[model samples]
Target chain A: MKNFHLDRRQLSVPYLIYLVLFVVMPLLVVLYYGFTDDDGNISFTNFIVFFTNSKTMGTLVYSLAIAVIVTVICLLLAYPVAYILAKGKYARKHSFLMIFVLPMWINFTLRITALKEILTMLEGNLAYHPFLNTVICMVYDFLPFMIMPLFNALTKLDSSIIEAGYDLGATFPQVLKSIILPLTVPGIISGITMVFLPAMTNYVVLDMVYNSTYIMGSLIGSYFSSYDWNNGSIISAILLMFIGFFAIFTERILNRGEKEEQRI
Target chain B: MEKTKTIIKMNNVRKSFDGKINVIENLSLDINEGEFVTLLGPSGCGKTTILRMIGGFDKPTEGEILLDGSDISMLAPNERPVNTVFQKYALFPHLNVYDNIAFGLKLKQLTKAEIDRKVSEVLELVDLEGFEKRSITTLSGGQQQRIAIARAVVNEPRVLLLDESLSALDYKMRKEMQLELKSMHKRLGITFIFVTHDQEEALTMSDKIVVLADGKVQQVGTPEEIYNEPANVFVADFIGESNIFNGVMTGKMKAAFAGTEFNCVDDYETGKKIEAVIRPEDVTVVKPGEGQLNGEVTSTDFKGTFYITFVQCGQYEMEVHCLENYRPGETVGLHVLPDNIHIIPYDTSINNFEGMIDGFVDGKGLFIVFRDFSMFVDAHRLYPDSSVSRGRLIGQDGEHIDYQGKKVMASFQPEDGDMSDDAKKGDIVGNIVSFYYIGDHYSYTIRTDNEIDYVVDDEDLWNYGDKVSVILPKKKMKYRLLEEQKQEVAD
Candidate 1:
């Protein structure tokens, strides 16, 4: 009995070992490399160089712009589909939602390559419209992420609250504005988080679609491939910080909308 | 007494989903201004459907829902001057208490100062004066109910619909809200239509009660009339604890039931079929041989102040409310007073089925074909006005009308039905689906092979699913014209 009791708590042993070795150690190594200079002296030389370079700064800003645009477009496209699916009188809603999610289950490289072909066929030359093609590919790849969270949150909404809105003399549009939009803010925020954070760093789509432009993910990759460990580690840390900021921002929006976990 | 204005009237409302079986049939009701009317029934009885139709959430399949003498059937929920407090008190979780209450008022585009005054005033009315800033999720269920009511009433709707609003709360909280809602109804002086399956809540809160079952209105009256003088078996069985018995009127002032005859106040004719209902509290317990009937106590359940003691005099058990405790097997007499005995006429709706008028033979009889059986009944039974002469039926207007291929409805009373154990003694063999003791005899439902169910009353008990033969009397069958007979009569 005593041995079994100990084993119950010891179940987390392998997970903790993997976390410390694979995750924590790599993060510590990145921190060590990021704080040191080429002569092995601890310094902020890499940060000063990355910040002072207008090219890298412009790439960061362009990546942020792409992420923002992709997120807004994904939200616009997913909200109505999720609402209609969740409004639910359709006999096979899960199968209907599956149709929306089926593309996400495909291999990422194959799906992006197919989208690149479709884009090339549509525009004649993908490099001629690198920004548009990348945005399209990024949205296509990350759409299911936005759709799943939104569909989940929307299906969980108490429809009676919407009826209560109509009962309170709210018209259809007014009910959507006053009741549904506010209630699904948490869903909208989660969709934004899933799309925005990934869109910033997913340079795979950029490379697959067009290589003329560089996002944060490609900048970090180029630095790492050149054996510039100090600059690559610094860029990774900055991207991680940006992700942390995005998470905190989404959390504020989610909390503001009174997430369902707060319900009794 | 001053006359009150009719605030809402439902005219022959019928609501069916998918154009199939109707959830609500041709139901008509009237609600006066300032009346607290409760639509009370079991689940799936269309009480909530009625509320939804009234609140403009659902449209009737065929009906005119009039609001203060104007048809509001075509109006949207927002366009209608009615509001509903939903069953779960559907408070918008994203909005604060103040914003939630001010929602409809803000839609009216009132000034901010005026909106504030109105919101706070309605909040005070529901006794949630200081809860304006409270988040809907943070407040308790009871507080949410108050705020929901406040939100709905702030708009000053002409009629307020509550679809089992208090049903979500705990027992004690439900009781408190019942009283608070009653006072709110009185203060607002607006028409309130509340729906609940809980009969006690309906009795306590409603000035009038509309008892419903199977999408049909059973009875509509004051709470006392509904409780004391139920219209039929459904209302009597649904309202409160009732010892209902299928019996007959022994005389002008007497009722015979429970294997005995007793004085009753209803002036039903002698030998007329009826039902007698006596409340548990109405039976006065007496010494053995002192009252009308003597019995031994079968069971005694202590209910706070009084014990509901069941006395078995014969096959039927009588429930009596007594302050003095009685042990099982103790002998006692039950005195049921004349005024206490509520005599309801036995409802006539029975085995009605769509049938075709097969033919009429010159000298024999009128042939009617129902499911799985064809029979010849008297011509006069179809309608007292018509006659079968020379192989053709004459209409009420004396025109020669072909009766074959015409549609009709064949009906018979339960009392006219009989059951036999031997197949040779009856027309059709069936299985007894269920049997419940009703004072003097067991009321049974028997399903035939063709899926036709016949409700028959018999003195002998039958087990469930027991095979029996039904004796459907030819003379007892009545037929009514279905469609073209009316048009012919009008022509």
Candidate 2:
């Protein structure tokens, strides 16, 4: 029995090694560079530089604001589509879902280029507006990611629970409110995380659409391009902290939802 | 008994999933107020489909479902005055027991105090008053079922549907909950429509049992009526353990089977063919030569309350349940009381073959050729001094008879033939073409070498592709002279 147990546990060794090598090692390197100066001596100069630069601070806020908009828009568009795919009469039409998800299978850069061309053709000069263009591209690219998680959440939900809601004198809207929405909290949280983090830091999408460097992603890119390793690592570390805070916030929201669920 | 009002009525209801095959065809059932009715059938027999239609989860392709005199077939599940406790309980994992029960009341925008009182009252009804704060996941299967019941009952709809609600609980818990549900039905005084494949549950809890098979209602009656007098072979076989035999009703209180005429209680046409069902418990075991039919005990199982003894009388296997201990291979006689014998009138779909007696062995058996093929019969009763040889059976009269050419009619119950794939040296060769598990045994439709289809039953396992021989024991085969019948003038 002991040998069998050991044999089962050994299957995870490769994954453990990969986490330490790729994830822990890179985070450690970023921490190391964030605290060191040009002489490779320990110092807080890069942190001061990142906090004091008005351009970097302004870009960070602008990136956050744009990510919030993109996340909101993606959620608003994806929730209903996901619900229709997962629970509606046409739920078994996997080929219809394939239509929404087919673009994801193509090369990312090629898909963005094609989308840029279509939007350019439709709006002409108006499509070139920097913030609007960036927001549109982010929502377009991240909407599938948002839908996927929400769809998974809605699909795993026991259909009988919704029926039970209806059987107990609740109308369609009441069932959705009392059962479907609260049950899919995990999916909504994951969708927000998936779209929010990428929308905050994806400079390539903004560059391909707007042809301008205006967000923290672009700021980080310019720092790396100039070979400012110390300041670049510091900004990267702060962005990691931002994601960490957001993750905690989402966790808090999930816990609060769970608590409310129990009280109900 | 007071005249009960009909709370729900399904009129000419038909349901089909794919439009080609109907799951429920032309079904009409009336559920009385405060009565507990169970739709009992095997899987895929449309019991659940009926429940779904009544609960509004599914709509019938045709016909109307009346709820208290109004057609509610087109109404949504929420709009109907009905609720359901699903098989899996379907309690919201996110909600506590109190809230789950209070959900219906809260949806009506009831005041907080009203909802709380109703929820608490329902929780008390299910015997889980203190479980108000417990999470649904934390409860046991029985508790969850109770909570599901509480959730539905809290709505106080005109009718409540339970789709095998206690099926998930352990046997002990199921028994307990069955009694609890009966009492709850009395207390609530609302119509309850239940669906289950378990006959014991249906028999114990239902005021009315509707036995369904292949999208048709076979019998609908009280538990005692369904148990004592089954409508047909399917109902007799499906309800409980029964010793069903092919018989002919010769007169009122008289039926003939297994070469002997016996008294029965059922009154039918004198010349009508019938199938007789005698419940195992009603058959008494007497001394070898004392009772109606003599047989040897093949096996005996001591069931705590009584011994289930299997007796072989000629070609018929009769099951007898009694407290008396009997050794295997002991000679015994089965005394089936007159009233205990139930006669179901002839079903046209039974297997009746016209054949000729091909061979005969004096004091041993006879061989009958059917459908251009011959099968052995182990019966010992035949005309004495009859010129019977290979394929010919001639009576005492001096007649130039071709033994292999005489015609006869053979008939037997589906359960008579014993099937075996390795019995290659038997009297008949057949392929195990198709089979369905009819609860107790597998009912196989075997196609003989002559391309004749015969339905047979086997307790032993056999697959679809098996090449097998069906051995029809002579004592089990029932036959009469077709030529003799043709000679006689029709009435």
Candidate 3:
């Protein structure tokens, strides 16, 4: 079972246990609740109701749109910052990386609470609008998740590759484009997954700051509060499926990047 | 043929990391078109600094660097008509061999067909014709090195700088690449300035070698001139194996050492101390009595092509290379032809010899002088006038006669002795004050009963404070009286 050439059994045991405890058990419970009517007869009523509701469908669209927005913003801002931090002088990198990472140390709840307070203050006293406040909060919350991986990818890259490009007569801009940017795709993929997944799932910052925001997290929260367990279960199931599909997509992307690097 | 013209010239280049300490000081050199020059030296000798200056990667703190006789000291590395094959052979990981070679041509806005043609031509030149589409990481170290050369040369720069590019390759591969690079230089006719610390590499490939040490250029010449005729002691010692003997000029053509006088070809200014360098191969071993240098063979090492023998005469051990195998502990005679010997003046500014004096002693109750007692035993065989029957003094006779027994002082010469039985050869003994184990033999410093000093080598183990008799050969000793007479006549 523990042989070096075939350690599948050794790894499978824990994975099986985890699958039974967390995934299988919760999924079974959700399915049980989702299929049963109020009296206990099996039915497809909850899923049907979930699909028919325009409000829940609109919530999904809003959630997906916001996630895409946050992911794009994080990718853009993280790339340049990460590039500069990795290639900049030692002292400059130290100070800039410190500033970029400082917010990560704060507790998630406290950070969101702080954002909420700032948003309220900005809306009331500074006369800023809610949409800009929410965008700013989401970007601030997810930035480090994006920047950390990007920085790691950029810093670990061999400077020789860039030098080779320059020596071969590529201008500075061409080196960055052909050599540096291509080599950093893995980090970019990782940053995208890190920002998109968490932002899609996380609702506290959005709720605390953007209370009226019609997103999936708020819809799920409203269903549970109204004692609509069947509807909530269906919504949760859809969210799980969405996350599963993305997980596979991300893995595929990462693997492709790896293969490309190897080929190069 | 017209393209083969003077490409680069660096004049009085100086650089320093810290404002006060210069790493490359007042360096100047010229690189002709199509010529291969190597900067050879030990580490921290500023060879790399000069290469960097020529490559335009570094700015000279003082002086100017000219490319094709135009000042390009202030130009960036890219703007100069030069490229570098770095020690690491920095290759783009993202680019295939074809793209790596095409990168420069592409940057110049060359058309696709031209770029492809040039890249293929270079790949063929480097013997990587079929490897154009291969990834750089997939290539072996030697292949990568060739690619590096190909990439640099394909640019058709007037000059290419290689900073230890072959250092990463294994010995056989390095040798192969060296030949390849040399042939490539001949075919392309591009100026190549190589920087390496390996003497053999510089000797094998370079048209000229510039030897550097301590941020200064020691000598610049062909491999034969640098190796056969070194400019100074540093260059002599750095370039190859050399046996150096420190001595003072005794006559117009004579240098006395180890109780023997040798006629030297080069004349030194009178009274000046100088060192003589002879290649070990120049020394020939013969029967003890027949050769000018008589010494006991302390040890012999058999290196496949030659036998290296260490011989001890008096206090100094001379290294001699001979073709014949000789056993250790055998007494032999060594002879070196006068023309083969090179004498270089010792720079007294750095090495102060006065501090080497052992102690001051009263000689003949007159002049008080410091004694190098070890030197005296070595001197017995060196001073011709000192024998068993006669003695010679180093002091002025008038001073000793003036102060005799009043404020008694005296100075003694090891060469000053008599040949009488009471003080005959091998009769005057001294107590060994100290012994230094110098590899194959022990150098013993003995102080005689008359307070005179002597130095000699003993193959046999002898402890400090042991009583040892000094053996002064009669023919080897001389009286300075005749030399004094000659000096007076000449004056």
Candidate 4:
């Protein structure tokens, strides 16, 4: 009874326990299996097999290319919608981001399947547009992720800054280049992170739409389903390492311009 | 000295938004080149709207805006040769000081070396020579304000618009910026259109000020002209501290106001109504029997260099700014020089009321009925039918005529109405619900028990919860018969 007060340290106990049970333990087990071989001997057999196999290496390169392409396309498509929705007049009457949000409320599989049916019916077959169909489904699934962050960023921007640019003799193109796009960098980075990182491994879109191409997620899935724990764990371990590096790498580049200066 | 040409002219410009009430009414103005102008008014007076129109951010709804004798109303803001320093010093948060100042210069065809030289030159002009590399967010508010100014001035536009740019700084910082901005205007020799609601700032910095109210230009003149010879009561009240009284001409170069008659310089028709404006600084304080009126000192406030002493005479409270100080309850006499008294002819904006002629009284007056009270007046004074005198409405054929329930429109100037502490002396009684002091006189709105209000201008101060009576004299009123309406609309 004397110690019944809920302090800040005590408040985080449940979160710490959840982290250990769900995140740390699974990561450790995967690492152990990924680094060791049969008979429980520690070895580099899984890494050697993964890196040496041309098919597996080729899948990684292919997945990277698809992720990059989808992210660029999604950004180019979502920016205009987000900017228009964030303006004062249009934002008051309707939250246009709900256009993306409503589709997201439906089950992901059903939405993707519906999109696949439309694309297949239009193109006559999914085989003819394996890369195109895969790219479309990936962008369709991740378009909402791109728009929400950009909208949030654009709305928080002070309209007076843009006006100041125009007042300072900047044309429309110059304002977009120097004032508007630079201000929304935080949202753009987050949108890219949310879209690109997940697009790299979303093999479900490929399997449902084309079934003719392979991505990192399907490669990991196939190896694990065949009871090949070492190879599957190695693939998962490589991906986890890649995500960890990519996040820090992106942050470093974003903050690179803000060098320390002597305060006057 | 040569007369500078007109740089900008707004011809019959009317601005409204989305079918709403107009923010700026039909306004025409001229801005001369190399002159510093200030659009001065209170909040929502369309001072900022005028600046926006000049900067090409807003377009006139019905008129042409000419820049240097050409129509530039449809040009974009970037295409116009004028720039604005927004109220909050809208500096780009991402850019450093040097880049922000050079933002405008880069839009032209200047080389990199020339842009650098011009940026440094303008930075020197704003006295922030070494702050070019500093980030905008790290600088103080006053510094950001300087950068915002530097950015616009670097472009060397024909005109510079400042939208309350110094209001964000502290009191001391704002004062310093005021002087700095004045000097900057001197060196640049450009047309500066500064917008501010602060009357003191306008008086201190502007060469000419255009006072605005109710979407209309109230007066436009140099600071001294606007202060000494205001066109109307609104200009007099808005520009400086002045005692505004509803005056009536008594004789040539003579008017009576604030319950006393005084000599003035301007001559109007005898019995012509006017507004007499006398600044507090022009009022001389003297001993009780030495001046035109005697009053008891009600209060004295010690300003830095002088004292503002308020004296309550018979009914008017006189404000005097003098070096001499007096204690409360002291008796003092206030006098104004004849030349110092500015007389402005009154406009016909008055309070109109509806009343009905009930009947006639025996040699006293005809009975008149109103919503709040009723009064008696002789019918011949208003409607001269020649036979309506002697308290009798005898027609020309010697037949007795009935004059009851006849509608008439009665109107009086707000100052013509008087108030009395005694309820029996007035035609109606009401409580003084609210009142505002228009520098010298108190404008009071009295609400009667029936929820009717009478707005009267009195010089005396009344305490809270005091019930007073309103007296509207028939001699000071004009009445018109509503014969063409065919039906009584007084009710």
The candidate scoring highest on DockQ is 1
Per residue, candidate 3 scores C-alpha lDDT tens digits across A47-117 of: 78777888777778778877899999999999989988997656578678889999999997788778777
Tell me the TM-score that candidate 2 gets on chain A alone.
0.84
lDDT of 3 by residue, B1-491 (tens): 45546677779988987465788888887777778999999887889888877776568899998887889998766676687898888777667888777777878888998988898899899998888889887888998898888888889988889999899999999999999899999999888899999999999999889999767888989999998778876777677777766667778877765456788887887667776777889989999978888899888999999999988876777888899988888889989888877777755443011212222233221121223222222222223332222222232322212111122112222323222223334545777765544324454556666544565555667776777676643344321211123456676
Predicted complexes: DockQ each: 0.56, 0.40, 0.25, 0.37
Best by TM-score: 1
Worst 10 residues of 2 chain A by lDDT: A255-264
Poorest lDDT segment (10 consecutive residues) of candidate 1 chain B: B433-442
Candidate 1 or 2, higher DockQ?
1
Clashing pairs in 1: none
Docking quality tier of candidate 1?
medium
Superpose all Cα atoms of candidate 3 onto the true structure and report the RMSD in Å to 1 decimal.
Answer: 13.2
In the range B115-189, model 4's lDDT, one tens digit per residue, is: 999988998998889887988878878888999999989999999999999888899999999999999999999
Local distance difference test, per candidate?
0.87, 0.84, 0.74, 0.85
Name model 3 segments beyond 4 Å from true.
A1-16, A27-61, A89-99, A112-127, A229-264, B1-6, B17-21, B251-262, B348-491
lDDT tens string, model 2, B333-352? 88988989898886756557
Clashing pairs in 2: B355-B408, B358-B391, B377-B474, B378-B474, B378-B475, B379-B474, B391-B403, B391-B404, B392-B403, B392-B404
Relative to the real complex, the DockQ score for model 2 comes to 0.40
Query: Residue A258 error for model 3, in Å?
Result: 5.1
Q: What is the DockQ ranking, best to worst?
A: 1, 2, 4, 3
